[model samples]
Target: MSDLEATKTRYEVLGPLLDERLLRLWAAREARAIGSGGAYQVAAATGMSLKAIQTGLGELDLLEALPDGLPLTPVPGRRSNGQRSQPRVRLPGGGRKWTEDKDPTILPALELLLADEVAGDPMGRQRWVRSSLRHLSERLAAQGHSASPTTVSRLLKGLGFSQKSNKRKLGAVGRCPERDAQFLYIAAQRQTFTAAGLPIVSVDTKKKELIGNFRNGGRSWCRSAPEVDEHDFPSKAVCQAVPFGVYDVTKNAGFVVVGTSYNTPQFAVSAIARWWQAEGRDAYPGADRLLILADGGGGNGSRAGAWKVNLQERLCNRHRLTVTVCHYPPGCSKWNPVEHRLFSQISKNWEGQPLRSLDLMLGYIRGTTTRTGLRVSAELDDATYPKGQKVTRDDLGKVSFKPHADCPIRNYTISPQIADQQA
Candidate 1:
C-alpha cells in the first residue's frame, strides 16, 4: 500500500478520506483497532510506515479511546497452560479495577512530590503534593498551558501518587509504642526490688576485649574452625571476649569492665566485683536484696556453679544485696532486648573505628544510644586479673548468697562466651 493508504488504514472506521498526519498520528494512532480502525489503513492515513503502525497498534496508548465495556477475548491455559486453558478474567476474585484514561506527565510530578514528602516521614500524610499539583495545573491556564485540576489529579493517581489522603500514612503501627510499652514493663520489674526490700539491677559484663593475641569471631580463616579436624592444629589463638551489662532495666544506663584475663573464675568475679563497686551500687541506694537476671552460661552461667558461689560470698556479701540469680533458656540470649537496643548500637557506632586504645572502647561504649537512651560506666582493671587461678569446691562453700525462695525464676545466669569480642 502507499504510505498514505498505510496511514489511512489506521482510521478507516473514522473515514479513509479524513487522513491527516498531525491528528491521526497524535490521536488515532493512539489505538490498535481503536474507534473501529484497522492498523494497515492507519499507516496510510497518518503517513507512518506500515511497520510503525503495526508496531504501535499493540501498545496500551493506542487503545486509550476504546469503550471500556467492550467484550474482550479470553486467553486460556495460563496456569496449567495445556488442558487448563480456560477463561481466566471471568473466574472472579482478583479482577482488575475498571478505570478511565489518564495523562502520563501528571503522574511523574505526583510521584516526585509524594516520594519527596514521604522520605523523612514514612507515615505518608503529605496532601500538599496533590493540592499543589492541582493549583499548579489550574494556574497553568493563566500561563497558557491547558489542563484541569481534576485531570491533573487523575494523572497523579495513575502514576501511583495518591491524590487521596491515604497514600502517605505510616503502617498500622510504629515501633515507638511497642518499645515504650517494653520500657514500662521493665521499669515495673525494676520496682520489684523495692517491693521485696531488695535491690535488683540488670547486670552482665559487656563483652570483654582480649589483653593479648587471640582469634576473633569474624576471622577470615582458610577453613571453618568448627570443621577443622582436632588433629589439624591447636585452636590456641583465641582472644578473650569483654563482658557488658545494663543496670536496673535502664536502657539509658549500663557499664563495661575490661578484663586482663577471662579464662579463670577469679577474672570473672573480679571484673564483676569491680563493675558493682562502680555502677551497681549507685542503682540501688538504701536497698537490701540484690537480684540479678543473668544468663546460665558466662562466668556466672549455672555451669560456672563456682562463679555464683564466688558472687554469693565475695561480690554480694561485701555489698550485702542478698544476691539471688536466674538463667534464661539455653541459646536464647539475644532475646535480651538490651543486646540490640544497647549493645548492638554500641557495636554499630564503633565499627570501622578501632578500639585501639582502652579509653577509646570505653568512649564508644558510653556514647551508644537508641530512641530510648544511652549510658555507660567503664574502668580499666589493670591490677592483674590473676589468670589460671582455680577456685576449688571447698572455696565454693565459703561463698554464700542469701537464697531466693524461687531462685531459678528470680535470678538467671549465663556464660557461653560470645564468638564476637564486641558482642
Candidate 2:
C-alpha cells in the first residue's frame, strides 16, 4: 500500500486508543520512517496539523539526547503495556500562554473596570465585581483586550474577586457622629446591668409579615415544599403581623408578642411589659431596674416622645421598675441583640414555611431553639393600638425622665412617677 493509505490504516486501528501526546508521537515516528515529505503526508492522513508533528519530532530528539542516569519521569497517560508512560507530554512552556501573560494589559484593564464597580469592605480581603461577566468581557474587548467571560471570571478569581450579591453593609444616610460612642456606652451599660443582676432586654419591632399563605425566604427539609401564594399583595392578607421581640441578654431567652394592631409606641411598650410580666420578672426576680436596648428609629425610637411616655406609664409605673432605654444609632439596628440573637432564629425556624395563620407563626417562634440553649416564648396580642396618637409636651413632662450625660438623645431613664415624687 502507499504511504498515505498505510498511515490511514495504522491510525484507524489505534486512533481511538491513543491520547493527544501518544498520537502526535506515533505520527512523528511514522513520518520519520517514511523519509522526506513524510510529515506533510502524516498530517494529511491523520488530520493533525504539521506543527503538532514537528513538536513531537523535537520532543523525540530531546528524549534521545537525555544524559545517562537521569530517571525517566512518568507522565499522566498509560502506554500499550497498561503502565504509566515515561515521557513528558509537552516541553516546558509549550502549551498555550496564559491570558494574563499573553495580554499583560488585560489585568490592568480589568482592574480599571472594577475600580468603579467594586463594592465590599475596604479592609476585607474578599471583594466582588458589580459588572456581569459578559459585560466585563465586552468592556475588556472595547479596551482592545480580547477575553471571554470564562477568562474574565478566572482572572477575577486570580485577582481575589468573586461573584457576590449586594450586601446591606452601608449605613443609613446621615449617620450619627456618636454611633460608635453609643455602641460603647451600650456595652458598658450591659456589663454594669449584668453585674448588678438587673434585667437587660433588647427590644425591637421585627419586620411586619403578611398573615396568609405567603412565600417565606429559606428552605426546609420536608416531604414536599408547601405551596404559597404567587404574589404577596397586602390586601390579600388577613392582617399584618407585627412581632415586637424582647430578648433577655442574661438569660438567653426570647419573648415575642405578635401584635395584630399598629406598631405604635404603646404596642411596643406593651409588648415589653408583657414580656416582663411573663418571663423577665421571674427570670431576674427582685430586679427593679430594667435596661432596654433598642433601635433609634422605630416605635421605641430615640426621638419618639410617645415611646418614652409609654415606657414610663406602662413599664415603669405599672411594674414599679426603673427603665433605662439605650437606643442603638440609626441604621445600626442589626447590632441589637433582639435582631441577630432572637429575631434571626425565629426567621430561620419558620423559613420556607407559609405563615398560614398567626398560630403557625407563634408556633414556629416558640419552637425555635439554638445550640447555645436559646429558648423562646410567643403570644398573640389582639389589642388595638391606634397610630398617630400624639404625646403632647404635657404628656412627656408627666413621665419621670432623665437623659444620660453622654449621648443624652440616645440614652435615658424613666422612673415611676410615684417613686420620683416620693424621693
- For model 2, residues 1-423, the per-residue Cα lDDT tens digits are 998999999999998898778888898899999999899999999898999899778766766777888965444443548776666555667667999999998988998676434433311234454468999999999889999999998999997777766557554467678976887798789889978988888888888999998998878899988988899999999899999998887889999999998989999999999998887878888889999988888788889999988888788988999999898877666667677677777877887889989988999999989888999999999999999888899887888899999999998888887765634
- The list of candidate 1 runs beyond 4 A from truth reads 1-191, 194-199, 205-241, 387-389, 401-423
Q: What is candidate 1's lDDT per residue for 216-259, written digit by digit as tens? A: 23323345343322231223323344654545443256666665
Error of 2 at 299 (Å): 0.8
Task: Give the winner by lDDT.
Answer: 2
Model 2: number of backbone collisions = 0
lDDT of candidate model 2 versus the reference: 0.84
User: Which lDDT values do the candidates have, in the order given?
Assistant: 0.49, 0.84
